[model samples]
Structure formats: C-alpha cells, structure tokens
Target: MENMPMPKTRKPNAQWDANATKIFNEICVEQVLANNKPQGCLNNKGYANLISQFNERTGRNYTRVQMKNRWDALKADFTTWKTLLLSASGLGIDPKTGTIAASDDWWEEKINVMPLCKKFRFAPLDNDEDVEIMFSGASYTNTNAVAPGAREGSAGNGNGNGNGNCNDKDNGSDDVQEVYPSPAEKQPVKRGAAYKSPKKGKKNFRDM
Candidate 1:
C-alpha cells in the first residue's frame, strides 16, 4: 500500500489583547481620516508607521506582518459585527439588548455591544449619516492602489466613478459632515457625520 501524505496543519493566529486591539482600531480610524483615505486602509509603509507608533505608545514591539495579520482578523470580525447590527436594526431590534431576535445563539454570543461600539466608533447604528458617507466615499477598497491620475480635487472626472474629490475647501452646503474625533481625544469616538470632501467647483484637468 502506498504511504499517504499527512495533512498540513496551519498555525493559529496570535491573539491580540484588548489594549492592542483598541489601539489598532484607533490608528486605523485616525489614519483614514487624517489622510482622507479609506477605512481599514493600511499599506506597507502605513503598516511600518503603525508598528513604530504602536511601539512608542504602548512600549510593545509588534512586527509589520503580525500587525497586518491581526488587522485582517479584526477587520473580518468588525465586518461581521456591523452586518449583524445592521440586520438587527433594520428589524427595529436594538442590538445592545440581551438577544438578537433575528440571529442565532452564535451571533448573539459573538456580538458584544461594547466591543462593537468601541471598534467601529463611527458605526451606522450609532449614526445613520456616517453610513451614508461611508457608502458615498466607497473608499473601502484598497486605498494604496489609488490611480496616479486620481488626484484630489478632480472629483467627477476620474475613471468615470466620480469619487476622487478630497480637497479641504468646504462647500456652502450642510451635506458634508466631519466624523473624526477632536484632536484632544486622540482616539476614536462615536459620532455621526460623513467624511467631508472638497467644495464642488469647476473641474481642472491639469490637476488630474
């Protein structure tokens, strides 16, 4: 009889402590808002910077690969939490309650209000407007791969998607909203607002 090859076992991911997870989420939100990038946007350079900052702030050493892996896991969990919350909210059920009426025990056990709220400071459940902005920006895609020609201020002219407006000038309308926390906070906080884009103006092709 031919010898059968043994099944390969994958190593389990390192568990991130509560503090590490909190700091990582804060860093992600801050970087996204400050750079006017996207949510969950962490490039290689950004990852290195985050590692340095994490070490400086917490005095803990975490490699880039480790941070990236942790981020991936956290993001997946966060996404699941958001989906469940949205579904529950749609049915007029408060997710903070003891049990989610539309969900199973697994979801009920996995969905914790404090962590979900803390992780997604700008979650839609807390603020409906934030969700609108998130959908409008649609920056959830890989932000590092932004096209060279897709510079800021050329909003409606890039790739026919009309979503590249990222200037600082404000439009004279109340539609734009600011979701980032105050500088004093230095961390993510729950608030309802959209990621403000540049004022709408005549498109300048040169800037593209």
Candidate 2:
C-alpha cells in the first residue's frame, strides 16, 4: 500500500470553540456567585475549606487548582451537597455562631431520648396485667423455691427454720399455714391459756 499522508489535526471549529467558551464563562460566573452568597452557617471560604477536607478524607492528593475546577462545576448544586460537606468535614457550622464547631452534644442526647437510641427501653410485657400467683398455701413448700424471709436472714429450705422438713404435715389440715400480717395490719396477739401476764400473774383476757 502506498503511504498516505496523515491529515493534519484540524483546529477546533471557531463556532464550537465559541460555544465552549460561553459555557465555561457561565460556569465560572455561577461559581463566583455561589461563593459570595451568605450561606447561613457555611464559612465565607466554604468552597476552599470543603476541598481541603474532601482531599483529606479520600486520602488523595487534590491540588488547589483541581479544587477550584470542582468548585466551579458544583457551584449550581450547592444546596443539595451542603449536608455532605457538613457531615464529612465537621463543617456543620451553627448558624447562630457564624463559625463551624463540633456538632452539638445535645444532638447525641436527643438521639438517646428517641426510639432509635441504643438506650431505649424494651419490655416484653409492656402492657400486661395478668400476673400468675406465686404462693397458694399457708406455709410454702420446698418446691416453691421461695426467697429467705427478712427476719431469718436465710433462704427457706422446706423447714420453717432451715431445720424442719417441708414434707411434714400438721394433721393434714390447711391450718398448718402461718398467718403473717403486714406491719400496717398487725394487732396484738390474744392471751391464751399458756399466757402468763406480768401484771396479773396469770392469763389476762383484758390484755388480749
């Protein structure tokens, strides 16, 4: 094949170049406008700061010139991307403060108080009303596994004093149960035939 001369690279068309230039100028103008706007919380130099933070987070080297180009590209979409800058760069400036600071501690506290918080309560029986009866007999048996009474300071072991067998029956009657009244409901015990009153030297019905 005969060697064909390679066509010289054509210069960009004048009309196309002019259109591209217009677009570029429009983009630069938008960037300047966005940069000058009074963003309530974002710093006056937000674009520059955001670029530095972005490079730090991505572990990539982005030169200032690259950041400038990116800023120009993103200027028209500032509102949508503002949150990304705020969260990632800790650039969540407080509007009232006019300067960025660490996010408010109350933000975490508010989260803790909500349903989504880790400290939220969980109750399997949140609204349950029916509770099973624990004790039914006068004297609870060993099978009940009852906790120790406060007076004895020792857990029950079937016997009344940790010595008697729980299986023992008192005449096979339910009367074997010991009636213990709450402190608020207690009354003086009646004097019986075995009672010896110090004042009377004998059982006193009046004391009862």
Assess each prediction's global lDDT (C-alpha) against the native.
0.41, 0.28
Q: How far is each candidate from the true structure, as Cα RMSD in Å?
A: 15.6, 40.3
lDDT of 2 by residue, 180-202 (tens): 33556423322123212124322
| lDDT, model 2, position 191 | 19
> In model 1, what is the error at residue 151, expressed in angstroms?
16
Residue 56 of model 1 has an lDDT of 85
| Cα displacement (Å) at residue 50, model 1 | 0.4
In the predicted model 2, the residue pairs found to clash are none
Model 2 shows how many backbone clashes? Answer: 0
Clashes of each: 0, 0
